[model samples]
Target: MSGTVSDYLLYRLNQWGVRRLYGYPGDGINGILGALGRNSEFQFIQARHEEMAAFMACAHAKFTGEPGVCLATSGPGAIHLLNGLYDAKLDHQPVVAIVGQQKSMGLGGHYQQEVDLPVLFKDVASEYTVMVSHPSAIRHAVDRALRIARAERTVTCIIIPNDVQESPYQRPPQVHGSIHSSVGYSEPRVVPKEQDLRRAAQVLNEGKKVAMLVGAGALNAADEIIEVADLLGAGVAKALLGKAVLPDELPFVTGSIGLLGTKPSWDMMMGCDTLLMVGTSFPYSEFLPPEGLARGVQIDLDGRMLAIRYPMEVPLTGDSQETLRALIPLLKRKEDRSWRDSIEKNVRQWWKVAEGQAMKEANPINPQRVVWELSPKLPDGVILAADSGSAANWFARDLKIRKGMMASLSGNLATMGCGVPYAIGAKFAYPERPVIALVGDGAMQMNGNAELVTVAKYWKEWKDPRFIILVLNNRDLNMVTWEQRVLAGDPKFPASQDLPDFPYARYAESIGLRGIRVDKPEQIARAWDEALSANRPVVLEAYVDPDVPPLPPHITLEQAKHFAEALFKGDEKAAGVVSQSIKAMVEQLKPHKS
Candidate 1:
C-alpha cells in the first residue's frame, strides 16, 4: 500500500483495526516516525517516557478488549518497556510492542544503541517475539505479532532494524522458503464440554454452604455470575483484579480477598463447605479455604491456572461467560436462605464499619474518607484506575463499585507508577467516559507528575473533559511502611519509607489544569465535587495522614504480635499508629447510626 517497509507496517496494522498507538520518539525509530507523519489514519500518542507508553498500551488493552500497541526505540527504549510489558504479561492482557533496532549489519559489531532485543523480550513476550531481518519478513512479523497477542492474551514483540524499516516493501512470492501472512483474527468461541459442566454443577449443587470467588477473568460474565450466585445461594468474594466483576452493592457479594480484603470475605471463605472459583487465580492460599476443608470446583479459560489455588474436585476449562451459561442450566437453586441472609447482614455491617473508619479522626485526613466521599459521588460509567500502594488498599476496601463502572490496576505485578498512565490510556480509548486515577504520593513522585504533562497535551481533544487524578499526598510510602510493621515484625525504616512532600495541586495548576488541595477532614467531599464539576481535568491532592493503618479484614494473632513488636522496636510513628489503630477498631465495634 506504500513505498517503504515502515509504511507497509503501518498499513498492515491499520488493516488489523489498530487506529491508536502509544509511544515515544527516537532516531532508532525515525523511519516509522516518518511514515506515521505521512499517514493520517493512525493517532500517535506521545508518552512522557517509554515505560509509561508501555503501561498506557497495556491499559488500553485492558479497558478496550483489543490488543494494545506500543512503540519504542532500540536499547534503552526497549529496556524501559519491560516493566510495563511484565505488568501486561503477569495480568494476562493482550499487548503488542513495536520496537526499533540498529542497522542490521551493525548489530553484531557493537553498534550504538544496539541490544539483543529478541532475547531481552523473550520472557515478557514469551508467546511470540521476532526481528524483521528482511523487508518481506515485516509482513509476517506484524501479522503474527498481533494475532498471537490477541489469541494468547499476552505480550508480543516485533523488532525492526532501522535499515530494514527504510527499505522498500516486498510481497512474499508464492514460492518455496517464502512465508505469506494475512491480517485478521476472530476469537474462537470456547465453552467446556457438557459433561465437564455437569460435573462442576454437581459439585456446586451438592454443598449446602457454597462460596464463589471471581477475578478479572470473570468481568464479562457479570450477569451470568449473578444468576449462578442466586441459584447456588453462594456468597461471592472478589479478587483485587476482579473488583468490578460484581457490584459491591450486591448484599451477598463480599468486596475483596487478600491482604487488602474485607472481613465478610474472610468469614465466607473460612466457613463455606464448598467453593466455586470462577475465572480467578487469587494466589493467596491463606485467604482461600484451607486444603481439604472444602470441596472445590474451579472454572478458568486457561487450564494451567486451575487447581493451583485450591484443590478442586472438578476443573472446567472454557470461556467464563459461555461456561457459566452452560453450567447455569444444570444448577439447582438452593432452598435455604440463611447463608445468603448472613452474608447480606455482614455486607451491610462492613459498609458501616468502613464508613465509621473513614470518619475517625487522623492527624489531617483519613485516607479512607477520601475514597468514601468519592464513592457516592462517582458518576455512572466512570472508569477508575488505582496505583499500587496505600491508594490500592483504600480503592480495594472502601470504594463501592457499581454495575456500570469499570476499574482496574496492576494486579499480579503490583507495580507502582501505573495509575496516571493507565488513566490517560483509558481516556484515549473511551473519550466520552469520565476517568479517574487514584495514586499515592510515592507513585506520583515516581512518574505521575510527568504524565500530567501528557494529560495536559491531550485533554482538549477528548469529548468529555472530566479526567481527574486524586493524589494521596501522605509524604510516605504508606503501604510498605505498614507492611514492615504487620508482615515482618519490624519498625518503620524512615530511610526506605519516607517520601518528600510535593505541591501536587500547585503542579497541576502550573501545567494548565484545575487543582484542588484538601487538608481538613471536611474538605474531602467538596474537593471531589469541585474536581468532578470542573470544565477541565483537575488534580485533587489530599494531604492524608500516613499513620492511618490499612488494617486487614481479620487480624491474626501473629499479625497482632508483629504490630506490638514494631511498636516496641521504636517505630517513628508509634504514638500516631497506636491512636489511629485504637480508634479504627473502636469505630468498627460501634453500631451503625445511619
Candidate 2:
C-alpha cells in the first residue's frame, strides 16, 4: 500500500497469478526492474534479446492458457517485441506486454529512444493499449488490460514512463481493494440451441461418407470428437494446430491436413460427401474439397469464423465440447464402415511409406530419421515445440503425439525461430516435463541459437530440467528450396536458398551446455541418449541431407511438370528429387488387397 506505482503494478500481477516476468533490463525500465527485483513473488527471466522475451511470454501463455507478461525498454527494445506479440495475437493467446517509454517530460521533442509505441502496437494489441500517465490510474489500466486479455484471449499493451514508474502510489480510498476482488471473467457454458443441434445432426445423418476437420479449439473436446466420429462413421483430418487434438494412433483419424499432412488425410478430404468442420479456420481453401463436391456443417465458438473457410450448410455456434455433446444424441449412427475403413487403411499404408522415408540411409543423414528416432526416445508427457519450416513438416508427418504429449508451432504466423523460446517457456511452465525444440539449421541460427544462453542462465534454477534442442542441420533453407522446385517451377539457385554450415554443437558446448553432433544415421540415437541424460541443457545437431524434399501427401500433374521443368533446367538435385517423388507415387498407388 505504501510502495511506488511500479510495486503496485507488480503486486496486481502477482494477485492475478503471474509469478514470472520475461524481459531484458534497460535504462527506460530501471524503475520497474528494481521493483521486480525487490518483490520475491515474481521471478524476472532475462533473455538475450527483447524479441525472445516476447516469444517466451507468448509460449508460456500458449502452454498454460494463462496471460503471460513481458517487458521491454523504449525504442528498439519495444519494437523488437512486435514479432513475438503478433505471434501471440494471431494465435489468440493471452499476453500482456509492459513497455518503457521516455520520461514523461520528454514526450514531443523526440528523445533518443522515443517511438510512438501505442500507435505502433495498435494493430497487434487492438484489445487494449494504454499509456499510464498518472499513478492513481495504474490500478484501473492494469485491471482492465488483464481482464480483457484473459476474458477475450488477446494481447494487451501497458506503457509506463520511466519517471512515472518511480513516482509514489496515489491510491485513493475509492479504489482500495486488490485486483483479486475485481479480476475475473464470465464462465458461461456456450451450447447451441436444440433446434440448431437437431438440424446439424440431420445434415450429418444424411451423408454416407462424412469427414471431420478439427483445429486447436477442438482439443478439449477430444472424447466428444471421437464419439461424433464413431456415430457418423467419419474419417477425421486435423489441421496442424489441432495435430494433438486426437491421438495419432486412432484408427479412423487421419493425421494433419494440407501440405504437411498424411496421404490418408488428403484422400479423406477428396473422397468425402460431407465435410464436418469443427473449430478450424484452415487458411488453405484449395486443400479442402471442391465447392460442390461436399456439403458442409461447421461447429465453432466464434460464429464469425463459421462458413468463412468453406461453405457450410449448417453452421452451429457454441463451444466444441458442449455443441458436440448436444448434437451426439440426435445424430443417427451409420452402419457402414467401408469409408472409414478405407481411410484407416490408407493411414496405415502412409505410415509404412513414412517409415521407409524416415529410415532411409542417405549421404549425410535423412532429416526424417532424426525426428523418427527422437519420437520413441521422448519421455512421457513431453512438451515439443517445432520451428516453422522443414522442421515443422517432419514434426507434422513423422512425430506421433500421444495423449499426454503436447506440441505447437507458429500455426497462423508460421514464423521461424520460435522453437527454442517456446521450449524454454514450456520448461518454465512444466519443469517436471521434458521439453524439446525441433528447429531447422537456418531457424536455429536465425533466432533460436541466441536463446541458448538464456537457457544456460536459468538451467540451474529448475528443479529437474530436461531441455533438448534438435537442430536439423541441412545447410540450406530446405523448405524454401523444395517450394522453389515444386511451387515456382524454378531450378535450385546457388546463392538463394543455401546457408552457411555452423558448428551448432560446439557453440552449445561453449555456452556451458552439453552438445552432440551427428553426421551418420547410427549416431543419432547415441547423440539423443547423451543429450537426454545430460544434467544441463543440450543441443544435438544432426547433419541432415538437404537433398531430401518434403513432398506432400498427394502430388498433382502440375507439380510433376514443375519438377520436370526444374530437372530440365539442369538443377543438380533434380534427379534425386524426381526419384523421391516417383517412389512416393508408386507407394501411394500400391494396391490394398483388402
TM-score of each: 0.99, 0.96
lDDT of 1 at 83: 97
Report the number of clashing residue pairs per model.
0, 0
Compared with the true structure, what per-residue lDDT tens digits does model 1 show for residues 1-594? 549999999999999999999999999999999999999999999999999999999999999899999999998999999999999999999999999999998889988878999999989999999999999999999999999999999999999999999999998889899997888999888898888888888888999999999999999999999999999999999999899899998888999998999988999999999999998989999998888999999889998898998989998888899899989989999999899888888888898999889999888999999999999999999999999999999999999999899999999999999999999999999999999999999999999999999999999999999999999999999999999999999999999999988999999999999999999988888899899999999999999999999988888999999999999999989999999999998877787643
The global Cα lDDT (0 to 1) of model 2 is 0.87
Clashing pairs in 2: none
TM-score of 2: 0.96
Regions of model 1 farther than 4 Å from truth: 591-594
The CA-based lDDT of model 1 is what?
Answer: 0.94
Candidate 1 least-lDDT 10 residues: 585-594
Clashing pairs in 1: none
The local distance difference test score of each candidate is 0.94, 0.87
